[model samples]
Target: MSLLSPKVPALNDPVLVNEWMAVATAADISKPTRVSVLGEDLVVWRSSTGVHAFRDLCIHRGTALSLGKVSDDQLVCPYHGWHFNGEGQCTLIPAQPNMPIPTKAKAFSYPCEEKYGLIWVSLGSPAHGVPEFMEADDQAFHTIICGPYIVNAEAPRVIENFLDVSHLMWVHEGFLGVPEHSVIPEYHVHEREGKLVTDTITVFQPDPDGRGKDVNNDYVYQVLRPLTVQFTKTDDQGSDVFAIMLHTTPLAHRKTMAYAVLTRNYGFELDDKQFSDFQDKIFSQDETILLSQRPEELPLDLAAELHIKSDRLAIAYRKWLRDLGVEVGVA
Candidate 1:
């Protein structure tokens, strides 16, 4: 099979196909924790000030530096007591007598930043800013931060699930999906500053069994390259709801870690506990299905497969990625 075929590529390729693989999560690597990415073992450490990342292997004997300890602002190797600073330069060598440390004795360092309640590392120079939570600053909205969940699927497939509203009816069934509705909502797809933005409006009427009254909901979905999806909802009553779903996949390509925040416009009489419960319920519904998918590599055949008009947004998203030079399987 071809390297870019259904078979997954090695994690150490010169160019990482996706940007989401670079995000650093607390659960993945806390202070003094070591993780591997792009074929290089790395250690992430915290000092009195902030966090730093460097190659985990010591330059002296190739021992894992993460197995060592943090001394003030420097990382001390456990094997030879060599000390390295936040800049990855070896600062001290206990055994060397009156000899200056060689300038070349430095560990490879990567640029990292903490944003949106997560740590992000850059494999290559990122020209764009980190993903932002659109509704985070709105005082009228109450926000809840749910923990991360590991899903066994490619990042693209997982993202497709969020962009695909059609699956809401079948995949979600009784939870939040509308199964009986046969009508497709009107949607608009446009590009904004190199990002794909989609707006869709769907109306729901009262069921004969007395489920709910007539309601119209508008959804806004934006795709920021590499790995970020923003979803905003507005109801007929002008009630606004916003959510940001961030997928940070590991370099291993076997799992994806996601962080989700759900918020609704404040001023409602609902208590904090009630609002928390509501957000949890909706996220739980998505978690259950995402965790069940196989961790297959991307490039799906959507054309040979069955599709409906409701899949318009999902199809557009795939095409957009392809236009950006992403490899996708053709029917």
Candidate 2:
């Protein structure tokens, strides 16, 4: 949170501060918009320079700049009509044009950039660039950006749910898996290039691709960042493949919004809306179960939750969170 707003929870965790989080889609910010990440309210907007992110509060009166408008590539303060340029420096003080603007009289700005149809912001200097999505660069794949599915639970829980295959048989019945074929094959997970990558874990899916065929689906999971994870699902012959990148934004302590970037080799014949709706159904199922989880926050202590053979991925995820010293969304 900003020092100006001491009442808000602090988001100064070293790991989280230096990491970039997706605050909005590139299409969502034509005008000044308010978005929360790690408990700080930021106003994200697009200017001639590029996408800009700054504290939502105007220094003059602490009014939310998001309530204001943009003109001539500058953000206008809603209360005093102060004009701030894309660099976040106060350029014009409507009432006192002759006075010199104080160096401190500026909107608190942060580093921001646009990539993969999303606007990413870092409250502090970024440790590294955004996670990689190889399929996004491949021309053979059709890519679609999905939801910012707002969930009531914290981010880690939502991410862990995405990494979990155990719930497929029950929660996603008939879509991803069925109880009759609930058995999970052994898989391997290890660290590679600062990421947790998993070997193929095969599961039986009743109707995975909407073709209504029962087939064994092989999955490989990777944790690219503390809050970003992905999985690649393929057929036995590796002729067909689907990959999804899951990015979660911590809106607040117990609130998070998840976005998915889906790329598939097949499905070119299907409408993009159909693929979006299909994911909407899958996420909706997880949302229900996630909301019902107790304590809201994910327990960093492994002993707090029971683990089984299939939970190895989740176990590694929790360890990763703990190792990073992330304190925002875990116990």
Candidate 3:
């Protein structure tokens, strides 16, 4: 469809609208969890077969299917007692016990998948597969699922914050990086395929999780998608690499959820609570400062904001987003 074709409303293709976002964890869906992604409410549930996600509203009476239960391999709606099967087809309507369900009664369903202990959904047609973090699937590394942090800023900006390690010194002083050691050496920023990558970063940081020995860490940062970024860090002396995936999901223009997953070989024997606490402390610092950036929307215009040599990654991230035809709520 052309941009001038009747000036029509854009179609919502979950996989194509934006990069995949982790809307819920697999554990969150016992019966069905109501997850909101970029203003679309989805009902995601787990069944004996696999995980399933739908548009959340019942076709019969516009009631939330999430408020209901799963019975006999179908999602039952609370209002008017309508039942939808895994494919979002209306199978049973209690009022008309024998009436055949029509094809139009099907709910708009999304392509949902579970990876790295999180439920990822897309509201657009996806030309590419979901992002890959092989460590999360490999057996050698122990994995810990991190937060569903609700940052009070737009997704693009929150994602930019993840690629911006320069702020760690001031914003996350005691926990993440110290002001005394804030020097960022010149790192070359280049794009591999479609992602922005930089690998020449080395920093002196304490053990991020309070368990490992402090050392100078070599880091490789990658902007996997507009709202997805990751970093792999390995202390110079250790053989283990701590890989983290930081993904931001836009619930709306100004509301976003940050989901993280960490894979490491060092802290497998440590208590899970300490790992959780340490992550919480670090992100709490980022959340406090990110919420205060004015014009909260990410700047696509290169000159809209000033930049320095250390902000090469952030600059590259914004340029990549602009090149992809991405806006606030769409990709």
* Stretches > 4 Å off in candidate 3: 1-18, 329-331
* TM-score of every prediction relative to native: 0.78, 0.93, 0.92
* Candidate 1 segments whose C-alpha is farther than 4 A from its true place: 1-9, 12-22, 26-30, 36-40, 137-142, 203-216, 267-295, 300-302, 327-331
Clashes of each: 1, 0, 9
Question: Model-by-model lDDT, in order?
Answer: 0.61, 0.88, 0.78
User: Which residue pairs show collisions in model 2?
Assistant: none
Write one digit per residue (lDDT tens) for candidate 3, span 1-331: 3211121113332333756779987788888889987777788987777788887777666788899898988888888778777887888878887888776777667778888889998776566777988777789888888889998888888878888878877887655577889999888899898788996698777666667456778889988877778898887876878888999887766888888898887767788778778888888888887889877887788888899999998888887777777767423
Best by lDDT: 2
- Model 2: residues with Cα > 4 Å off, grouped in runs: 1-12, 211-213
lDDT of 1 by residue, 1-331 (tens): 4211222334533224335344455455555777554434568877766667766677777788889888878888899888888888888889994799988777766666655556666555556566666686676766655545556555666677777766656554454446687466777778888778886656342321112334455667888764567777666677645455555455455556555655667435656565445445555666576667543444444554566777776777777766665542111
lDDT of 2 by residue, 1-331 (tens): 4424333335557788888899889999978999988888899988988999988898888899999999989999999999999888999998989999877778888889988889999888787998889987798998989998998889999999999988899998998999998888888789999999988899888977566667788999999999999999998777889899999988877889899999999868888887788899999999999999987888989889889988999999999899989988889
Q: Find the 10 residues in a row with the least total lDDT in model 1.
A: 205-214
> Roughly what TM-score does model 3 have, to 2 decimal places?
0.92
Better of 1 and 3 by lDDT: 3
Comparison by TM-score, 1 against 2, better one: 2
